[model samples]
Target: MSLISTSSPSSKTLPILRGQHLHLWFDHEKTKALDDMNYAISENEFVAITGPSGCGKSSLLNLLGTLEIPTGGTLFFRNQNYHDIQDLALFRRQHIGFIFQSFHLIPTLSALDNILVPTLGNSQQKKDVTERALDLLNMLNLGGRSNHFPSQLSGGERQRVAIARALINQPDILLADEPTGSLDSINAQQVLDILCEIKQQQSLTIVMVTHDPAVALRADREVRMRDGKALDMTQVLT
Candidate 1:
């Protein structure tokens, strides 16, 4: 199992997420999708990963999300070595939140229920979970839409529900892949604003992948990738 010991503030100043010489290959492939990539993301930092379609940006996110393990190297969350963790599912459930471009909400559930989905595994009181979900939905400006189903909401509203669902678990890190891809420009900007606000209000550490330069420009740090390698291209905000 992964080590769960608490360290001093000195160590807390260390990266909240770090990849040590990460490498990945898919199913006996001749080429590696991620070639010995190394990255360190600090607590509460907003980072963006950008690249062409095949540049391994999503692979990097998968590795960081613990959905995929590296063929070589190690990924650490706080002080824990993820590959050493025995109960990965529980570990992830407790710590990581994900937002996908597709808005993966349950089709039959109302927006509020979709937001409450993650809390089903938790032992918190129902009132507490409902309160948390309501707070997030209201903050995302979807309070009036809570009773609606996924099909009844607009694209942006659906994505807001998806974002609320991700936050229900109160995760330490949020991973988003093209979160605004399907929205109109106004909706995209609205989603981006909400993301920034949440990061600031909750002190969240976010790692988002985007093809849009506009989205990349919104991050505190932008990392660009090409041919399975990433490089720090710009620091737009901090």
Candidate 2:
């Protein structure tokens, strides 16, 4: 990964993420998944990406989350050019948190263990991290289910566990891909409410990709994509 540090042109606002001319492609694929995309997300903002299948919503999220490098162009996180740095792994561990539709909880581990998984290796305040995880779980109404394994919990409960895990590290940004997918309508709304609440309570910056219109509506701004390009964009109050 590259690392270049520079403040945004408008320092009055906190631009936590910025991407310029981003183009990404898979090997042997002639078409680019993300083509010359440019966007910026400010601190404590909730931005949502919406589009039909294969519109590159997830791909864009991956790039912003630093899970993948752009084939061409640049990504800046906290005023640092991410591609300039080589320590991509450390960068992800320290600055990014991820949530997914599948929950991605370790099937073998209990809810508590799943929340503690990311903090297992690499350095952090262990006691504080563990306590924070528990606190998050409690806040999500999962306190009584701490020792329950993923298989034993309801779908909504498991996703709650995933959310708790993602926030354990107090990451600079949160990237969620279809976080409410694979759940019933009621459960999906509950998870969405929790996400909005977390963003408000912690002043967290979140970028989420969702196919659901209601879920997308919760964000402060929405970017629509089609054929690997951002189409129309708009902002709405949460």
Candidate 3:
């Protein structure tokens, strides 16, 4: 691991996402989820945010995903400031995809339907979205499980569906919070392999939050957090 400061400039390409002196507080400034955090993620880079519980890893991920706004400081997507984006939901739909540890699939919906959930109010035609969903399922090796419900599928299978769903929208950034946290080692490795392949094939930028150092090692860089701030950012030598 090559240690680097959070404020260091990237020599390769401009950051797809960047944060400076970010702060997120709750309950009238009582809970500071993010305190003076600074970070940057280059395009097509796979970066991991790792830390102990309540260290604000997920909170930072949420801010990057545009699911939550910061209380202070600045966040930028390329040259665009986050605060300048008026419609956060539309911005997310166009630029971000999310995966969670729990799968978060609807028990009543089939795998394919669940995958199509993100496309549900979009202007795209139903046929097009369905075709894309099927393609994603096939890519994740879950084509045969398209009709399987969350309850009917194994944990790994359900997670695969969630992965497919995240890619269905063709977002520029994939924000994953503990995507493999609930799986066994074998399944976790499988999921990481798929993500790697996806990144190569699609040139996707992945920002993942994980507690496992092994998983963090798989990323191009790791941003370790503590006390709601980035302690350091390190480039992983492959």
Candidate 4:
């Protein structure tokens, strides 16, 4: 799993996302979660951010996911200033897929229903989302569990359903915050393999936060952090 390769560029190059000396403060005056983080994520690359707990890895992920805006510095997506974008919901729906460590599935919703949740209240997506959701369930090997609710499934199965939910929108990038952190060894490996397969099949750019060295080694590039800062710029994959 130590094998590493620079992401070979395609005939056409696209600037997917970039962060310039970013900063994030949980509390504007007291707590600073992220400090001076600068990184670039290329098209169709799998990049893992690894570090000790509370080192701002998740905060960095949140900023990249566009779920939280940085306190300072510039963030760009598709060459446009993301902080200035007026409609984040539309932007996220078009380009980003997010998976959290908690699984975050509604207790009352069935696996299929959970996966289709993002497509609701929208005429274009709601029109043909059933088939898409079903396909994702099948892809994640949860086809038989479609009718099962969160309480009825194992931790691994629930995470897989969450993954299906993230992918239901056919997003360009998938952001995962410690995706396999809650699973057993066998289940973790299964989830890792599925992520790799889907990344290749869908040509996705994945930015994942992981504490597991084995999991970090599987990524095309690894960025290490400490004390809410990126350790070095040269350590990143270009």
Candidate 5:
């Protein structure tokens, strides 16, 4: 785990995340999953990474989300090299939140407990954090389903629980990997709408990887990838 401070990001800050000449390898076979990928994301900007399957979108997301360090080059957060940080888990817990297509919730835990999981063992007051968890569940339209287990909830409801869990620590950045891939069209659209709403209200930067063009189009900018390198980047609405 890497060391992290619980400081909030200011609006005037430039480039919340930057990666230059990044590379990643696996096994002794030297399979370069990420090859010289470079990109930057500004504060509160909604950016999407889109490409064919196995094009390294998830790999890039992992780097940006601080789940893994680059094999080469550097990754900077708020102009600071993240490599220098020693407690990566602390960094993730304090600054980065992740959402996956699978919704990764525990089947036995109630929706509220799942949301409150991340807030445990931290310095925040338990009662207050529990209240916030309930609020988040309600905000995501799961107010009446707090006691429901993941098995009992619908696909959309489970994903909403995952979102609430991710936001429990009030992270500065949200990293999502094919967040809508497993859902039907209607539920996917609903999830995207909720994401946009959260971004506007919280002013948090979001970097998402999506195979669906419609989902990618919702971002402020899209970076296209091929052969593990970014290319033909374009702005969507800015």
Candidate 6:
């Protein structure tokens, strides 16, 4: 199904992200990771992509994050076609952040260092980047654990560190794949609360993939996928 925009025509802003008839194939086109999927996300919206295993949840997230190129169809970022973007890597760094189920933190690096990893080799001054990283750590409530490595932190702390790293670049969009899948109930809820708070505070557009209905309900809207296609997209009733 095409996930058409429901916004009023009087609105001037365009969707921050949109996918039109997107397809991603594997195994010589035998495996359709995404088949004619259509989706859109507005600025500052929190969207959850929910489906069972192998239903292309992660694939869709990858496409949105520019980590994977679609084999067919087109994607747009605020009306700019993906194919027109000359530098995918730079585009991702400037506009997108990613969180994963595994936390994806560097075990050997301190929390502050991990948060600063994305700023490496960039034109941003070292002093400024360090200041931003420290600020993010403090914002995420890790003010006292800047020196702690991933190995030394608890599951929730590690996830918060990952979140800080993702936000270090000040991205406009956050693509999270099963962000709370690895945590227990309490930690999962805490992480979800953090995401919601960050979204409101930073005006970030979040696209999260998960199989948990409870988690999906936490989002502003839920897009249900099946057989690599979006079956339904509806706003969650508060």
Assess every candidate by TM-score.
0.92, 0.91, 0.92, 0.92, 0.92, 0.92
Candidate 4 lDDT tens digits, 35-103: 888887788889999999999998988888788988999998866799788888888887888898889
lDDT of 6 by residue, 73-190 (tens): 9998987899999999899889899999999999899999999988885799999999998888888889999999898999999999999989989999999999999999999999
- What are the lDDT scores of the predictions, listed in order? 0.87, 0.85, 0.90, 0.87, 0.87, 0.89
lDDT of 3 by residue, 1-238 (tens): 7586567556346788889899999999999999998887888999998888999989998999888889999999987899999988888888899999999999999999999999986999999999999999998899899999999999999899999989888998999999999999999999999999999999899999998999999998888889999886343221
Q: In angstroms, give how far residue 21 of model 1 lies from its true place.
A: 1.1
On residues 174-228, what C-alpha lDDT tens digit does candidate 2 reach at each position? 9999998889999999998998998999888999999999988888888888888
Model 5 stretches with alpha carbons more than 4 Å out: 1-13, 233-238
State which candidate has the highest lDDT.
3
The true-versus-predicted C-alpha distance at residue 179 of model 1, in Å, is 0.4
Superposed model 2: Cα runs more than 4 Å off:
1-12, 233-238
Clash count per candidate: 0, 9, 0, 0, 8, 0
Give the range of the ten consecutive residues with the poorest summed lDDT in model 2.
229-238
Candidate 3 least-lDDT 10 residues: 229-238
- Residue 228, model 4: lDDT of 80
The superposed Cα distance between candidate 6 and the true structure at residue 93, in angstroms, equals 0.6
Off by over 4 Å in 3: 1-12, 233-238
TM-score of 4: 0.92
Q: For residues 1-238, could you state the per-residue lDDT of candidate 1 as single tens digits?
A: 7686565557558788988778888869677898878787888999989989988988999988889888888888987888789987788788889999999999999999999988887889999999989998888888898899999999999999999999899899999999999999999999999989989998899999999999989998888888777754233212
Error of 3 at 73 (Å): 0.6
Candidate 2 to truth, TM: 0.91
